[model samples]
Target chain A: QQQVKQSPQSLIVQKGGIPIINCAYENTAFDYFPWYQQFPGKGPALLIAIRPDVSEKKEGRFTISFNKSAKQFSLHIMDSQPGDSATYFCAARRYRDDKIIFGKGTRLHILP
Target chain B: DAGITQSPRYKITETGRQVTLMCHQTWSHSYMFWYRQDLGHGLRLIYYSAAADITDKGEVPDGYVVSRSKTENFPLTLESATRSQTSVYFCASSGYFGDKDRWYGYTFGSGTRLTVV
Candidate 1:
């Protein structure tokens, strides 16, 4: 079964707008959540991550809002730019599980 | 140069042919993983190696084999290529994936686009 579910197969927003992507997980044991971004011809890079101990974490213009009770997390990109266009993937793993499950990716586009 | 790298950036082969994909990491991480990316399927793990000579099968390991001869090299082989195997392959490395440190964000290599006819 797919453990993680993500929405918005494709997203488009204007420059300087806030773009958000949501993800929910079925396994309550998952304690670590991370988001990755991939460009056209390159490998995916770690963007930001968070743990259930906290409700939210922010770095630069990227923020991950998590809800432990709801078993959901969403990524917010503030002042989205054209350079932010890429595919974003959400993943999760139990504290001690070496295997991490990934959600279906969401393609984001920023219109100038 | 001090990160994971995948070679034969692109390859094309016919069905029933054998093809191998190479992955190398300089970080000397304890964990290395292979994943395949397709149009509808996002990224599916094919195999993962915790250390040299120690490997395990992932969700989609059928029709494939992996060998970790050395700490820095993990290779995946397709015994017989199939049209269903035509997808982009990615290799990743991480230090440790458990509760300690709890940082499992991976360092991925440039993908290898394999096409099986």
Candidate 2:
């Protein structure tokens, strides 16, 4: 079973617009949630992360809105740019465990 | 000059042949992992090592083997290649998860694209 599930396998937004990608998880034991961004021919890099204790976290133009009770989290990109086009993945893990379960990923595109 | 790296950025092999993907890290991180990414399936873990000589299976381990003889190197071996195994493989390293203060997120390598014909 997929521990983490992501929606909208692909997304498109105009530059300067906002694009949102969402993910849901079943494991309540999960304590850490992180989003990764991957460009073609490159490995996924950490974008931003949030702990369940907080409702949201932001870094630059990226924001992670997390709902602990709902077991859901979403990534929102503000002022989306053409360079933001890439694949995004959401992951979850427990505080004591070393393994991270990743979502299926969403490919995002920004039209100039 | 110090980071994780994958070998043979690209490789092509015939079915039934043996192939191995190599990964190395210079930061001496205590944890190393192998993951394979496929279209629509995302990235699935193949194997991981918490320390030297301590290796464990991940979400997808069938038809794959891994070893951690040294702190810096972890290699994944396919005893017999299969068409289904063709995908982009990535290696990542991180500090001990037990260390809450220094638990920097995983650092990934450039990845190796392997094709099984």
Candidate 3:
């Protein structure tokens, strides 16, 4: 069973447009939520993260809107560019647990 | 040289051949993990270790083996390679910072593209 479920396996957006990727989790014990970005021929890198305490968090052009009650969180990229095109993954981790569960993934493409 | 790294960026092995992938980290992080990434399946954990000499299986550990004899090294081995095991492998290490509230994150290696025939 997939603990974390991500929607829209792939996404395409125009440059300067916003691309939103959403994820939902089944475990309420998960307290930490993070997003990762991966490019071709490279490993995934941490993009941004959010804690359930707040409903939203923003860093630069990336924003994470988290809905604790609904057990859903979404990542939004503002003014996306061609460089932002990559694979994105949403992950969840339980408090004090070293294991972090990841969603399948979302491939985002930005057209210039 | 301050982050995690994986050896043999790419490899091709025949079926029934044993292969070993190496992973090394400079951060001395307490937790290390091995994951395989495939199309449509994303990243799936194969094994993890909290510290040296302590290892555990993850979601997929059917034909893989892992050992962490030292803090800086965590090597994964396949006793007998199978075509189904062909996938990109990643090694990661996690650490915490901050005094009041700890912040945790993972640093991933470049990855090893393994192809089994």
Give the whole-model CA lDDT for all candidates, comma-separated. 0.91, 0.92, 0.93
Which lDDT value does model 1 have at A1? 72
- Between candidates 1 and 2, name the one with more favorable TM-score: 2
Please list all clashing residue pairs in model 1, or write none if there are none.
none
Residue-wise C-alpha lDDT for candidate 2, range B7-115, written one tens digit per residue: 9899999999999999999999988999999998999999989899999999999999999999999999999999999999999987745667556678899999999
lDDT score at residue A70, model 3, on the 0-100 scale? 96
Q: What is every candidate's C-alpha DockQ against the true complex, given to 2 decimals?
A: 0.81, 0.82, 0.87
lDDT of 3 by residue, A1-112 (tens): 7999998899999999999999999998887899999999999999999989989999999999999999999999999999999999999986765688999999999999
Please provide the root mean square deviation of candidate 3 (C-alpha atoms, Å): 1.1
Model 1 Cα displacement at B39 (Å)? 1.3
lDDT of 2 by residue, A1-112 (tens): 8999998899999999999999999988887888999999999998898989999999999999999889999999999999999999999976665678899999999999
lDDT of 1 by residue, A1-112 (tens): 7899988888999999999999999998787899999999888888999988989999999999999889999999999999999999999976664577898899999999
Ranking by lDDT: 3, 2, 1
Q: How accurate is candidate 3 locally (lDDT)?
A: 0.93
For model 1 the local lDDT of residue B67 reads 98
List of clashing residue pairs for candidate 3: none
What is the Cα-based TM-score of model 1?
A: 0.96
Q: Which residue pairs come into collision in candidate 2?
A: none
Best by TM-score: 3
Better of 1 and 3 by TM-score: 3
